[model samples]
Target: MPTPAATTTDLTGRLAVVTGAANGIGRASAIHLARNGADVVLIDIHESGLAETAEEIGRLRRAAHPMRVDCTDNAQIVDAFQRIEREIKSVDILLNNVGQSARERASEFWCSEPETWDFILKLNLYTAMTCSRQVVPGMRERRSGKIISIASEAAYMGSQGVADYAAAKAGIIGLTRALARELAPFHVNVNAVCPGPIRTAAADRLPIWEQYLKETPMGFAGEPQDVANVVVFFASDQSRYITGQSLIVNGGRWWS
Candidate 1:
């Protein structure tokens, strides 16, 4: 087994495409990969934020490319992959990091708006499927690739107010397993990191964050880097023999 220090240095020269890279775990993952010598392309729906990420990564003496893409749209997703292929030549790693969670009570689908449920499904689950579809062909041809999806711990331990979110995350786990089996022949690994409550800007306003912290075994929620580090591990050659797995990094709050 490779030690942590050894794995950090193994990602050098890899090319990674990280979706939802404008902020939070995605941004940190892109930066972390760059710091370790990977050329990164940041993808997100936010144009200005993506530019800022690119600028910051450029300051680190590593290359960063940002593209504003609505990943839920299959046409747009396909086009972005093609553009990246033509412009960057190859994408050795893919981080499906875009996700949305609802605060509505769980098991209350009767009260959920159809539009809201649809949007959450498209954002959290279908987008991963669409993006992976575009990238796997190239990976199969190259006979090497890493596909890492960011899942939530709620997928395992159901949450109170996120039925759609939990369902989508569980769906992602199933997708990861199926893809792993399908891609194993080509040496492409598919996995997910299910993080517990993270203190990102988007979740800062939630009143329940403190409650989650209190319940956590570590006595605190996690940071983006906590999740990013696991992502980097799955995306690198260090995990050449690991696949079809979901590594839960939840501060020991929940273990299976």
Candidate 2:
């Protein structure tokens, strides 16, 4: 049997791969992971943002490898992971964080185009599956790993004008539970973090930003770091016994 994770939160010597690490929660989570002593591999399509994130991690004295890959493309994802395995090391933690609501094209579901739904589903759901596929083999072989995907409260609350986004994120929760069950025997943990009303660059651009704040029970929007803290918990030994669970980080918005 594989050895268990240590009882503390220290991530020393562990290698973590975080997608969408260019900014927002992805960037925050990567930084937090590094602060906890884990070397991180940052993946994103934005080169400038990746560089900035890497620089910050460098200041923390933790190894950070930034890879600019369009995660929506399966070929690119496969190629990138191949490079990761060859150049870096096997990933001990995989953060499937690349997703978008495609707010630019937001419309009522009846008015939504198939093209928009396609983009939303691919970016929000398929990317997680593809990225997880890359690391699952190695993790299963090693009999230990952590896979965390960033889902959204919209999945449960059923927000308007984002049906596609909600469906995609809901798919993430479903994927987490199924994969967790499948990998549990190998000591791998699969989980989802669902954030609500976090004040991200993307969220700030939403037309309903003011409405979201009003609806939030906390009476204020959350920061990316708020969600990042929960992510760090799942990434550390603190969550070793937790799997197939979706932990909501929204402040009193919805209860599970």
Q: Estimate TM-scores for all models.
A: 0.93, 0.97
Off by over 4 Å in 2: 1-6
Superposed model 1: Cα runs more than 4 Å off: 1-8, 103-108
Task: Give the per-residue lDDT digits (tens) of candidate 1, residues 80-154.
Answer: 989999988688899999986864333466677777778888998999999899889989999999999998898
User: Per-residue lDDT for 23-73 in model 2, tens only?
Assistant: 999999999999999999999999999999999999999999999999889
Task: Give the distance in Å from residue 10's predicted Cα in candidate 2 to where it truly belongs.
Answer: 0.6
What local lDDT does model 1 show for residue 225? Answer: 94
Global fold similarity of model 2 (TM-score): 0.97
CA lDDT of 250 in candidate 2? Answer: 80
Instruction: At residue 181, give the lDDT of candidate 2.
Output: 96
- Candidate maximizing lDDT: 2
Model 1 scores worst on lDDT over the 10 consecutive residues at 1-10
Question: How well does candidate 1 match the true structure, expressed as C-alpha RMSD?
Answer: 2.9
